[model samples]
Target chain A: MSNFTIPVGPLHVALEEPMYFRIDVHGETVNNVTITAGHVHRGVEYLITKRNVFQNVVLTERICSLCSNSHPQAYSMAIEQIAGIRIPARAEYLRAIADEIKRVASHLFNVGVLAHLVGFESLFMHVMEVRERMQDVKESIFGNRMDIGANTIGGVRYDIDPERIGYLREQLAALVPEVDEIIEIYRTDSSILRRTRGIGVLSYDDAIDCGVVGPVARAAGIEYDVRVKAPYAAYDRLDVPVHVLKDGDVWSRAMIRLMEARTAIDLIHQCLDGLPDGPTVAMDERPAIPPGEAIAKCEAPRGELIYYVRMTDSPKPERVKWRVPSFLNWDALGIMLRQAKVSDIAIIVNSIDPCISCTER
Target chain B: MLDTTTIPLAVLLFPGGLFALAFGLALKGLDRRVAARLQGRVGPPLAQPFFDLVKLARKRTMVPDIAAEPVFLGTPLIGAVSMLLAAALVPIPGVYAPNPLLGDLLVLLYLLAVPAVVLMIAGSASGSPFGAIGFSREMALMLAYEGPLVLVVAAVALRVGSFSLSDIVAYQQTHGAFLFDPVMWPALLAFLAFYPANLGIVPFDIPEAETEVLEGPLLEYSGPALGLFKMMSALKAVVVLGLGVALFLPLAPDGPAGLAVHLAKLVVLMLVGVTLLRVSMGRMRIDQAFAFFLKWPLALSVLSLAIVALA
Candidate 1:
């Protein structure tokens, strides 16, 4: 009943990846939460320097599995900007399709895990089953499931043939209704509402102060999405409606992702319909890199994923630095956990969708 | 009528110890399988709970150095032994009747609470912070649910004019089941709410909310000690569900046919009330769950008591 501290998850089951929290509690209420975030550090920046620009594409994608496509996609975009190369319109659309598909899968996985943390095993299983349709599409088209090897230097690696396009459309149509059903349940279920609503409140002002990205930011009424604001890849050419909610609680964070997944499906359909006819690759010869520095940012499933690439005149060049969305969002956890009951801590932590591996990398 | 000497056999073999253990594990398996099917997956085998028990036994029993070795190791044994005795006190209408010499409905009610108390003691003794959190939640939940349960039992005892479970069964048989009596319906509903919370399933399983506290008191437990806890739960399920059968609806023809009917009723109650409910809803926080029990079930049980008194 007195003041005490509970250390959670350097290797605990509650955490998906290794990270530790020193939670100081007076009785059941959490007084303060101090987090340690270097448990999964792999020294990825040093590893990136060992590989050439061409090989770094594969290496960077391994940074985090959930946001795998965003890493390579951003890295390639940064390199293209530095070298002053223009990708064909067709390749841009292909990259958009891949990114949106990954977004849907990643967001659904986060929501499913929320269900699991709340001890709603059935919903977790059901959501994962719905997300598997996208996984199958990735495997069929891009030839891999998790790391969809879709991004190349100048263009996308795989094209949506007429057969694959038909298959993709069928999968998308099936997925939309299923996702809608799940969203409806999450919105209306009183048990879920009781656990999530008003439980982990990160005010809009605190959100902006912390610079929280993705759904966590959007939930707090921050209307900043890099895809819409900066317009990378095919986003500049297409109309992408950003999803935002006023409440900064766990429920709003979950709802933001669910609504955004629906929009991602719509974006994929538009990308396919607006297919431009041209060579998928801009040139047969690889562009030579000059000494330069460029930064590229993309809207990943979690939030804004930024890559900073600096090139010297060598095969293995200067540095490849990435600032993943989870890095900033993990810092705001202290605000969320302050005064929350011990029982709500897991759901609150999961609400931010903290990617320890992404942050530590 | 069976001789009083067979009470030991009843408690140890036929309807109590081995039989209750097997039936309870099977019910859990069915619950998991049905829940999985509802979610569109091929679930574990019907023998999965038994397999888990076996797996737990094969593992080594670990005693945390910080833990109070006596209380920590002894509570699971105490809990299992209590349920073994309680299962014998439940009379299966025309099939089997417990001897009056072996305690009655009042004793069974007291026995029903031992598992929760054991859990509280076990949690406090484990010396883990999560265990302490679990201990407090377990205590709060117990305070909430126990009041309504006692009132429910009081209502049934008043209706039969005796605290003996066999008399309650006899009264229900001749006068018709309390389940169909509109006056006793409040008690039935109250009891329905009471059992799931007692069983430590979702909506009331905040004490061991796995993601939050990592199985709470049992976090530091492993091997045969953990196996004992599993056995205690399995036996407790049979005692609670069997108690429900005796109190509300104990009407079937004597012999194996009656046993089959009783088993069928337990499976139906477990599948619908526990499994389906667990699948459909997320867990409530401890405070919310505590408030809920006090508001609805408590009021219902008090109403049942007033109805019984008036009749």
Candidate 2:
């Protein structure tokens, strides 16, 4: 009956990567949760501005292994805005292609962790297996599975050869049926449904109050994806529809990912259909270190990843700060875990795709 | 009865400690294979259990910084002992127990259950929320299944007109194995109801629901201790199958070829249980599992008891 402190994560049990939660419990109920962050801080912001804008592309990509593409894309979007360079139509299209690919892979990885945490080891392994197909696509195009370094300052560094383009389309086309099967497996299957549905209820109002973005926001019926709302890069060219859900629970989060993955496939198909003739990179001179501030938001795998860069025309930026998706999403944990039993914490935490390394950095 | 005084050394070596360990490992492997096949996959090899034990035995044991000392060490010992004691009484068809009283059916059930209980304690004593929650779920599952299982087993004891396991086996041998008694269907239903609870399969496996609870009781069990628990788990599987044989089948190992015949029958019974589990079902939800095992098994057990009382 006495109030007791129960610490979660940071060398404790987790179904996914480690994060910390100091929950004050009264019997079975959690009266309060004090979250302690900064365990995964690598001082990335301090490290990035050390290099020029060109090397910074690769440096920003290193911000997150899972959200690797988004970091570079966001950084480059800021750079493109500053340089006052209108990216070639083809370049914008390719940027969209890279962003969508990363989204699907990252979402798949999160769902796989969710499956693992839920003791649906079969589903976990199966989803990971399906994700390998995406990894193959990444490797063939970008040389890495987790950190696909595709985004560049003015446009994208990578060019898709006709053969590689054919291979990419073939992979996504083959993936569509399997994605549907995964949807059916997660949906029609009773056990998974029982574990996920209503397990972590996040109301629409709370999502906005918490500033939850991307799929979590979508699950909570927030139609505020940076891609659709304030379209940038190739997203402006493509008629991308941001997915949204009313009941923001673990199941809806998973459902959003499934739908988004399907959309990613469709978007890729569109990209290949409208493969432009011009160059992938812009030829015009990239802007000199602009002594101004630039901000850009991206739909990172976890949520809306916001990047803020303040430069004083120095080779390195004067200040760099980012609102990591996990940092923002982790705030929602205390509210979500309040009424639920202790067993649902891992599932609920996993649902938001908490990437400690990415957020802490 | 082949000189009731001194036991043969061969019997001790062949059927006592080594036999129990082998049976435990084999059953553990069998459960994995069966679970895997049902899920449309090929699981680890039959020798995987053996390999796993060897690896666990070799692992360096590190007690968690915040864990209670003996709860860590003592739980696995109790678990293994329960499994060992249960194996000693399971009647292996024709084999004779050096001590048959250890198989006091209820004693066997309690002993087999010790591993899971101790695991929960160990998980909680580790001082982590995730571990504690896992422990909580395991405790809840235990609370749900523990009563229904006892009722079912007690019903069988009533059917045989004795609580002594050997006496029940003897009774079944003489007057048609209680399984063949008119009380068979009800007892069979009760046995089926009790199976998932015993295995912690499907819905009843709330304690170790990895996605949510994160290995429940297993969250704290790492290195050598975890390995011991893992072996104890395999041993527990063997013990459960052994109980299934002793309680449900009640095979009589008597006569000139009684030893060979009874052991063979016990093996066949276990194999059948495995096959039935493989074909019949998948994991159930914790609440549904609680409901099914309690309501159905309690009703069936009550019916079986009624049949025994009337007959």
Candidate 3:
């Protein structure tokens, strides 16, 4: 029973993302977890501070591939708050629509990852095939599949017209049946249930103690979702429902993601029904950065993503400190997988939706 | 002596081991092309196997530091050799097998398992977590499919009244093929279960589950080692289908129709199977596949045996 280190990252086998975790194994059981990242680190924190607010719109999207929009939207909202500007009502609704669409695509991607991890390639392929529609919407509307540069300082830069909105509606319409099929698959696929049900159990209170946010928090029966608790953008204007499960195991987290994606789809249609006609950006030209410190929080695909800005009447911010969701969720990896079999680690790690790039940045 | 030598040489080169390899390669190519077409993409050419073999042979071998290197190195060659031997034992067109009894329907179970056991041992010796998990699951799946497959093969042997491949063919020639028999309809049902078990597709592929286990038993196999594994998989796929076809249609020893005609039938059988299996279905979960095989196909195989016994 000699202690041996099994590296699970950077270029190690099993990890799909760019982060690494070396677990100390005694025979077949993991006794300790040591994580290492920075492989995809681009020093975005420093880059964002130097760049003008307009250029950083594209810059912040690189924070996380899955939650690409939320980073920019939250950053934009922070900038607008610092200048004490009121964004156009229409702009807020559009931001909400964009965020919700991104949520659906992101959640589906994670669910597909889980399916793929469980060796259910049919469900994986189907989820991926269905996800192409979301990609289409993002490309046609935002001009890229992963990085959709939607947010401006005061509001959104582009607007979706009736024709494009109708197209978006059509894609969501087509995805509904398949989404229903996927939900049933996850529900009844007994092996998936068997492996995931009680495998990565974390009590409700333990999650809150770890400062986990979003779905991870909600799965543990904590009534704390950034979207629901502190409503921002169109979230403030409308009633947003949340899905909560008492079991904080890997499967419960997955169930929460699936339910939330459905909610996101519904939220987008609601935004479309209530979308007002007007200019996307405010009339403020040559908007200057005022002296202040502002903290912006948005429910990213993984969890609560927070960005802090400290401006001293200069265009450049004095400091840019942000907390990536993976930093928090991945810490709980040791807790979840300590005594579990070596085989369960991959799927359990996937349930956290680790954004290694964001964590490294 | 000259006449005997020429006949033996012709048999060796004509349609025995070489035919099995070519036929298996063609079926694999068809499976890939058909699967791609179903997924809406153009696939690789028919001669892709030649390129693959060349590439694999040229690549450097890296045996894992912790592995039983000799065994890991040896199993692939052994699997390939064993598969070739299995093919040689079957009655190939224009060839005389040394012993056709290995292809006897009742005793077919253990003979068919030689390649898989070699693979499992290779994976187990690799000394990686994925390999361990993969090999463990493979053993389980092996046990799962074995029961029904044995029963089905026994049913065929009962219908034919002899254990040798040549005798089974003679019976088929005398009594007509089992495809005509009502009892074999249930055996045809068993063929459905045999398909996944043979290829070890998604649901049955618990050993090499790509997403979770990171290619399972194959996690450490690269270069020439991986190549041999791939070749064995493709060849065994054809062997499995050959067993199914022989049980149902039972080849008639070419007769006046010639070697080309016999080979043409095997090729058609492989192509039809590839089309039906590759494009039409997706891999099931392991538990569901196990349940489906045991509950339905096992029952069907037993029923087929009962009907044949009565007949």
Candidate 4:
């Protein structure tokens, strides 16, 4: 077995989105990885500039389905910053609630796919079934599952009532036990540990060098979370615990996500309990736009999501650009995949939870 | 006595050709249904594998431009035909016994190795990178597991002092099944590990891992050519499980009752061993699986042989 190159995907089963990797291997061990992305490039950045400031919120939400909530929320925050509109206390809590709800769903979905990539179908199915409870909560509260149109320019679009609050609490209570059980299984399951632990090791140095964020960064012992580091919405008021692990392996990334999902549920509960009674919007009508630019960052489920918005006299913005977490994390694959077995390629790629749609946008 | 007249009937009708194929397919269907139930989903119909075979047979058999067309097309035929013949060799215990002229245990061992060989040939001949990887992994895995399997068979043969499977069954019948014997437990455990690796399920399915290599050797196969590979595996399920029964636990009242008991054993084995096991574990890397087989099964088989010979 001399050196040979194998293509992983633009359409592989392991990847949720399109991205190709031309891997050079000596026998079964990978010597190098060459990634070719942009299959999912929708010219979204260009499209963002065309849409009005208000319209861009909808367009940005469509950038990535998993982090859909964070996009509009971050974009709106930047818009609010430029307009100098301080949202009511109740809207801040509402925004945080929506953010946490999306975080729970996103993290569980990533870990569930990890189980799937590991070939643990039963665990994968179980995790997905558990995550369905959160999906139901999203649909019930926000009127949709994936893209939960939860953000507006001034505040949140949706608000939770007493009945919805009760429903969410009940779901969370049920979800806690189920998620705890899954965490235990992932912790102790020899099959999972064998395949993941120490397999795709990215050292703390490599992680810092790659500038990976979200669970990928935290798993490598980076004590960074935008919610805590630079709090937005009601995150500063809520107690956000950042879970970090030193292993930086595939298992560590999955474990970090699972732990954060547990924390997100708690954060959601805190927001619901501290609900302030006030107007959901900052103003009675749409405020007039002024010429200005602003930058806003929020902790998305994956990691830090930053949005830059510049407005002119026109309703449409001069430019709207976003730096999604996947952009920084994609660089870490080269280090993780070095000296990796061909079998671990999918698992390692999945560990980053790479958003091709967001990265290529 | 060698009976020439009954050979074709035995091979084609009662226990080998149509019967084995149907029974094997049913086992596959049951495995899928049980696995789905375990995973909390309503799976495909019990006849889904059969429907897939029918659907595949209706599709076109594609040959890649770089592939050795003849060898690529020929390997599945060889694999399917070999399993069909192997199925005839497995005795159904008190219901049907293979004639002495047809061949015995050693011959069955050689035939059992055919599918892996055919896969290796098919893989390389396809001229695909994934197929090449599959070929190498399959070869490594076969090398790792085959040694244990032969030792396991040798232990059983030494215990019974015969290579004839019918004689092994008869000995187990009077002396009680070897499955319950302490000395044979290591061999039984070794066989248990061997079958899953041989059957190519999870934890040992690294070679054809759909996520990793897109079914590897079978990635290039489609239509009736793919249908033949499916049939080969289906028939193989019967032959391998049937072999396990014949060697260790061939205890049943003679006649139709014995046939019923034999079918029952195979279903249980397929559901418990194959279905439950595949759903519960992730696939092991090729090196990990190879190392596992060499370390555990090989050592256990040797221990079983030593214990059985001394006892």
Candidate 5:
């Protein structure tokens, strides 16, 4: 019953990435927590300056697999802004399609891991099976599952033809019922609710104070989503409904992700319906780069992903930096873990959907 | 009264040692396979648990520098041995009945408690903080669940007017199994809850939740030492499930048919009670599980005991 300190990972089953937590506990209850990061840090920010503007698009996508599309998309958006390039209307809708596809996959993956951490392996497997349809669509459309390589300086790298669009529509139609079933289970299952509801609570005030974003912030009742607020790519042309909840607990976070994933499918369909006729790029030839600086932000699956690009006269950029949503969300764990049961540490950490590669990179 | 010559066969060959070990490992394999199928996965083969045991046995044991080596090394042996013996005590109705000299229901109950005790000892002696937390949680859970378990057993014993498991089984065989008897329903339900908690499945596997406490007590265990712990749990599945069958529904044909029926019932109990239940649920916190055992199972068992005594 005496106070003791336990290390919760540099390596552990619950975490997908390595980040250590030194938790001090009085018996089963956590009294304090100290987070030590930089385990998976590859110094990608520094590596970005070494690569040229066009190559860094590929480099940025490698930063985090879950938010892979967002990184390159945001970087390209920044690069396009610096070069004064307006992407073609058709390309804008194509980028949105790719973004929503990744969003559905990423959100489902996070919630699936939540089910896993909850010890509901059956539900976890079921969720993953449903998410597999999105993965298949990515593979069929972009020719790669994780890193879709769907972004370029001026616009998107890939476009959906009528056949591919039909395939996507078919997959999305099949996916809706499975996702709806999972959402219903999360809403009504006593075991999941018992473990998640009111556990690891982050208040609306605390969420704002911690500067949390995306599902974590929205779960805490903050009505903020970058797609709705900033409206990048073709999101301005599409209807993106932001899901919000009041509890700000693990269940709320998972529910927000589920709702958004379902909404992402709708957004993809909307982009397909509003498909326009034009080029998928700004121009046929590669444009010359001038010394300039610009910032671009996009709604990543986790939250708002911001890219800051500074170009010098040289082919290599002077600097490229990003602020991922996980950076702010990691700070909220101290509040969440405070006075939580030792058993809930993993569930609470998973609730924020912390992307160590994104945050540390 | 003791049949000294047949003791070794009882303990080492037919029922306890080799047979129970194989049966236990097989039960574990089936459980895993069935659970995986339930989750829509192509699971490991039925011999997977046995393969793991062989793999573990061939590996070298590594004792931590901070650990008390003797207790840490010895607890798994004790736990495995206790269950091995407990398995022998469970009568297979018309197929086999243990000798009275080999001990009875009360002795089996005490032996049944050994695995949890040694797990506690192993946890504390391992010198890992996670192990220490696991020890405390296991102890708390044991304290919570043990009351209901003992009371449920007591209710059954009072109904039959005997502490002998064979007697209880014989009584059920003639008058009708307690499984179908309305009077024994509360005790049966209490026992149903107790086995899952004792077997360390989801909603009750708090002490060694791999995510939370990193498998807690077993975090520091490695090699053949870890294999023994696995063997212990596998044997426990057989012992606990077999015990449930004997206590409530020991109605089967004589000889080989009875053995077949018993094994079939054990598999069914395992699939429905343990595997299906575990896959479908999330783990509970120790406090929540502690409260749950105290609230429902304890009350039901006490009600059964009171009713049985009066009747």
Candidate 6:
């Protein structure tokens, strides 16, 4: 009978990232939600400016673990644009392969947490187990499980031999069928539908107005994928299908991730098939930068990751700024959680895949 | 078999206290392991729940400055003890029958509801905002499920023409179990629906929903107090499942085989009805779950009552 404000997070189990929400509720219905960030802020932008171009690749990649490859890849692309360096075709395909693999793993991780938040523990575990295969692929191919460190100044640092390519092919072929089965379960399971179908609806207009990106934007029926729209890296070479849904609810967000994971699997296959036989990295040393201000954007697993670089003749850059997709996706949480039940708050927050480490960094 | 001294022994030792606690914890462990296997992973050991209780016992119980100390500290004890008594009241067909002086089906119903009431009290006493939300949710869930439960009990009592559990079991023994009777099927189905909600498992565990409320009332509890709550829940599981066995299908042979049969039935029920169901479904919001309980189970119980009255 009492209407009170419940403060969730900063240390709550539901939150994977460190953020706080002052949720005002009248009984079961959440009346208002106020979000606060900065818990995981690492001051990486200022730190990145202190480092040289080669070091900045390592620094930017440390920004967020889930989209670690995207940061370095985007930062490298911006420097490539400034330096006018053309990466070899083989390196471009290799970069795309790394990005797509991360995308599948990242999307699976988000969807798996969604299942956890909804209290379907078995589904959460199953989704995570499926994601483990992608993690293995990243480890086997890129030499690391989390921060793969694939991208350098001119191109990708990691190359696939025919055996590794065969390994990657075998992994993807096995993963696709399991991913399809999970997608089918999410699509038709009555309990999942009842919990998520209309839980946190973000209309197409709201999604566009909020400038939501990645799976969150696509879920709102907005055909705005940075891969399809901007065509960065090897995405331009391959036809990356933009997966969209009309509902804009938690269900749509989850479905979008599963669909994108499928697309990512196929994209990886295409990248491997068309992988050119050339040098993986253009230069053995860090390329010399005589750079003006340049901006580069890449579609991260979460959304659009943009890096802005400004450099003079010196090795250390004047300034380096980056905007992560979670920044855009986080604002939409206020809209999504408004008027939602207390039970739906966790799932809705998770549906946005709001990466606090990415946003605060 | 119906002595006053045996009543306390039954309540404190064999059927209730130690026995119920051990069985309940093991059942929970089995549920977790089976669920993990179903999800394709290596689960915790079957002794995991027991280990968790031991771990909880070693921690500190912190009471918030705003909390009512006695009520907050006392509820878990009360909840656990209530289940201990409730466990003895559940007759295991031929092996066990509670003393007539101790309680019967109706008294057992009131005892079964004590844990929810204790949870509500604990939530309210903690004076935390999450606790308040949990308080409201636990109250709502109790209100929603109590009607169908009472109605189901009424139908069974009316069919047997006695308020005592022993009479109901005896009637079923003489004239075959109600589980096989076409007319009592609705009541049986309603009882099936009621136990999961009563046990506070998924789809109906909206009150202590871990993600939303952070285990609600038990959030502020730690150390042995939290362990007591865990023990309370474990015993409550046995009591509720045992009640379902007693009310619907108490047809085991007399002696040690009867006790084995009863325990096996409890394990099967816990695995199939609780573990599998929890794994498959998502938690329902309070309103949705409330509406569900009031709609189908209420209707089914009412129908069973009407059918029993006519036939």
In candidate 5, what are the lDDT values of residues A216-289, reduced to their tens digit? Answer: 99999999998889988888988888899999999999999999999988998899899998999998888877
Instruction: Tell me the tens digit of each residue's lDDT in model 4 across A194-245.
Output: 9899978988999889888999999999999999999999988999999999
Q: Give the TM-scores of the predictions, in the order they appear.
A: 0.98, 0.87, 0.85, 0.99, 0.98, 0.98
Is candidate 1 or 6 superior in DockQ? 1
Q: Runs in model 6 with CA error above 4 Å? A: B1-5
Q: True contacts preserved, each candidate?
A: 0.85, 0.27, 0.23, 0.78, 0.82, 0.77
Q: Which pairs, if any, clash in model 5? A: none
**Over the stretch A1-361, how does candidate 6's per-residue lDDT look in tens digits?**
6678889888899999889999999888889999998898889878877889898889888988999999999999999999999899999998998999999999999998988888888888889999999999988988899999999999888888899989999999999999999999999988788899998999999998899988899899988888888888788889788888999999999999999999999999898878879898777787789959899999998888888889998888888888888889889998999889889999999999988888888
Interface RMSD of each: 1.1, 4.6, 4.9, 0.8, 0.8, 1.0
Candidate 1 docking quality: incorrect, acceptable, medium or high: high
Estimate, for each residue in B1-311, the C-alpha lDDT of model 5 and write its tens digit. 12242766877876777888999899999999999988899999999999999999999988989999999999999998898888888888787788888899999999989999998999989999999999999999999999999999999999999999889988998899999998899999999999999999998998998888888899889888999999899888888998999889999998788889999999999999999899889888788899999999999999999989888
Q: Local distance difference test, per candidate?
A: 0.90, 0.73, 0.74, 0.92, 0.91, 0.90
Q: Which of the numbered candidates is closest to the native, going by highest DockQ? A: 5
Candidate 6 lDDT, B1-311, residue by residue in tens: 22333877888887887888999999999998998888787899999999999998988889899999999999999999999999988888887888888888989999988999999999999998888888899999999889989998999999899999989888999999888999999998988888899889998988889998999978888899989999999998899899888888889998788889999999999998898899888888898899998899999999999999999
Tell me the docking grade of candidate 6.
medium
- Across A150-209, the per-residue lDDT of candidate 1 in tens digits comes to 898888888878999999999999999999999998999887788889989999999999
Give candidate 3 misplaced runs (Cα > 4 Å): A1-7, A12-15, A23-38, A52-54, A184-206, A246-251, A338-343, B1-14, B64-69, B92-110, B125-129, B176-195, B251-311
lDDT of 6: 0.90
The deviation in Å at residue B280 for candidate 3 is 7.6
The C-alpha stretches of model 4 lying farther than 4 A from their native spots are: B1-5
Instruction: Give the TM-score of chain A, superposed on the true chain A, for all candidates in the order listed.
Output: 0.98, 0.95, 0.96, 0.99, 0.99, 0.98
Rate residue A157 of model 6 by lDDT.
84
Clashes of each: 0, 13, 1, 0, 0, 0
Summarize candidate 2's per-residue lDDT along B77-98 as a digit string, tens digits.
7776566555555555444543
- Candidates 2 and 6 compared: the better one by lDDT is 6
